[model samples]
Target: MTQKYRSRARNLLHLGSTQANENFNQMVSSKAPKARHYGGSSSLMNRVSATVLQKNEGHSYLAKDLESIPDPIKLQNFNDFVTFDLETTGFGYCDITQIAASVGSSKYQSYVYPRCQISVEATKVTGMSHSIATNKLYLHGKEVQGKCIRTALLDFIDFLKEKDQPILVGHNIASFDVPILSRLLKEFGLHREFVRIVPAYIDTLKVARKVFSKEEVNGCYKQCNLVEVYLNIKYDAHVAVEDVNSLQQLFTVKLKDKCTDEDVYSITCKSCKESYTDVIKNKIVSKVICEKLSKDGIALQHLQLANRRDPNGLRVILREHGVPFKKCEDLARKIQEE
Candidate 1:
């Protein structure tokens, strides 16, 4: 079927299923992971009981209005979504330094003080060093203040709650961000409480990899790294807010059109495939510009690559033309105007 027809059918099915208000218990949980065990008990059960009993201060409405709530997967127009990103201290997991999320125009961004020291490698990549994090250092092209991780998590949760718990969108979030968030929430004894508030997620990283499986750069494969996917976009990486902004653009342009009711959680992405695709795309883009400018015209024409939003593909083309960074930017403007 044509993409348009498929989308329309998907929308119709979503609306019809949603209005039916299929029993939550009747709904299969194949897509969702087993609820994390907290102290040898199901956190989801605890949350459901807490909500049903109206024992929670803010969740009284949940008790009165448990049924008829739209199942996340059955939403027709999935526009009510939030994109979020994180900058962490290191790769050890959950040592978040900064977090940012945006839904439509609303935004929530803040830096968090890590419980452990930021690693040199991570600091080099993210520019969030231990000194800067501890001393409230200025990084990522701005002054940053640090909040405690638990406090940061709560604030982000509050932000999600305030936003009505929209679908969470993020790059590589399924693998990294969600687990870290869950771990942090559990560590702080708020997992069961807050897990109920956060909504379903759309991991752009997985979606992009699956949909754009054929795209390659150089001879290597690529996965859904925000930096690589948005190579043409000139945004500093490892900054939570900037990455989310890029992610938002990618979702709108590339991933959103392909979003379906199939539980993304259930769709397992091939790490090897995504990784190879990512590496290939990166190498081809950079190698073409940084190494092989001779194939510029063909690359620009055939690849039709984007480096951010260049006016008429000016930035990338100019780079291939061997223009210096400063001069090429000026020339790009002139070319765009002409």
Candidate 2:
């Protein structure tokens, strides 16, 4: 454990899980959806202070042994962001029903009309049926699951493009929602360009741990369950609006404190597997990274699969390709904007 995280862990212990979370709900999570709406970056924007939310920190008592945690970013820049969640019909790389996004109190909810029978595990959790999703969900045959879902997404993008911008949000979005949705969108040939400003995506569960639950629990394990976060914040479970609402609450509560992106970025690195975080935090640098990847004889298009971000990931590729980090960072942004 480094001195920084050790200090963080110690502070988290005193906050006690529940109180710490509520503070975050009130401070940080609150500003997210609206922030993404304006084309900023990240779900939350501010500096991070462990003491701001937690009175005492929790640690595993050692720093080196603490490398297994999936460090999530306590993102800010709520100036332009969206709060989104999905009630999937199945888990892990499968189609889902109920995809909901919210900007402040206003929300966008739609159900996908499944082409096949709903998965049993999914059925157990969400109680959604093929019939119910098809017959009852809002976008059954429109632009989305039907025309309605599709239209909502289209309108959502247009709204995002217009000053609002898209910052796709949901629980565990990076692992399942993003990869699956991006594939689905491209497969269907849907036009999903985001707002003029580059979109900065966030996952509420990740935000919760980064801001509220700073204890020494395994970040990867903690992130796997959204219910854990809800319960910790003293919020109700199993309801889409309520869960997203809780996340929003979490976002607002913890962010009012002063914290930097570097803090969140470092914490996130401890949990998730990625090579370069510098790119994850900077869009222009990431753009430079894409260029470096191409120069290295790597497949640029394939590397961008689903916009799965990591400045260091691309940077490592460049390093292997003998490209200078500063050169890639400086040039890629220019290329991307042009």
Candidate 3:
């Protein structure tokens, strides 16, 4: 069937089957890993909860809410931007089960004890359980998962500490890795303000969709799985470092010369004094804005992916509604320039 038809089928028959809604969560958690537990629709971020960003009530309600280094933006000064990933008990409400990151030239992968029972389903694929990998590597005990995720996360932050901008890049990172890592970081005292210092980021998934083609969105929504995108490139772990490596490789193997090469170099971020690519910088600004604009509750539950609005369309939306959008837009534009 066409991607469109398949999506239609999924939506009509089982769109909310695995959602974090009361009924679905109750049913799924019964079989899924207990650690992978998720709260449901109520736990999601509003804007990301659904595709609808606005309503035409003749107007609409409001809402809010990466990557590469070129040669010019290389990590010449500061530490590396540390590419990473997390294999959670479940995508929505489930807790983090395994965390993996690429540190420098090597790799760091950990199967964390989800502070609670991991769901049965989560174990089938993730191969994780309550006793999974204890003493196998650096670990955060189920009890310590909350206390030390941020500390264990420091392994990632340290690598990004160079004079250059530490740019964290990964596949599906903006939605998955960053949020989880940020939550853990806050628990560790990094606080909200210091996040800006963590270097820039890039989600190859986002970049590919925005800058390249996204007919691939079909596989899950309408066409092909991520594997289809790089049918030639083999991916193993479905885990972090490997996925990041796969994504980083995609830019090279698939895009070849089309992708940014040495021409664009990393510039040092004023704050970190670390070198990071311009491409990564752009994503950082975009992310910062998303955090600023995101509406509470709903946006978290949905895990929305905010898109860049065209200035002209934005002007029209603001002018017509008499909202203080211009000022906000001005700030975004300023950040964009920096």
**Per-prediction TM-score, please?**
0.53, 0.47, 0.46
lDDT of 2 by residue, 55-172 (tens): 1222221332222212122345435456566665575656546666666767666555544456766765565655432243332223333323345446545545544434545566
What's each prediction's clash count?
20, 76, 56
Query: 1 or 2: which has the higher TM-score?
Result: 1
lDDT score, candidate 1: 0.56
The candidate that achieves the highest lDDT relative to the unseen native structure: 1
How do the residues 1-338 of candidate 1 rate in per-residue lDDT, one tens digit apiece? 48756645522331223321333332323222356444455565655544333322334445333222122233353446788888877775548888898877889998876756777787787887655322444474465666767678788878877765367788778778776776666545565556466535677756766666444433222223533645556677677888787777777776777886543431112221232344246443333232222211122322222333446565655655555787557544533443
Local distance difference test, per candidate? 0.56, 0.45, 0.43
lDDT of 3 by residue, 243-296 (tens): 656555564454334424221211112212212234236553233333322211
Instruction: Assess candidate 2 and give its lDDT.
Output: 0.45
Stretches of model 3 off by over 4 angstroms after superposition:
1-81, 103-106, 132-150, 191-196, 211-231, 252-338
lDDT of 3 at 318: 29
Q: Give stretches of model 1 more than 4 Å off.
A: 1-79, 132-135, 138-143, 216-231, 266-338
What count of clashes does model 3 give?
Answer: 56
**Residue 147 of candidate 1: its Cα lDDT?**
74
Error of 1 at 269 (Å): 14
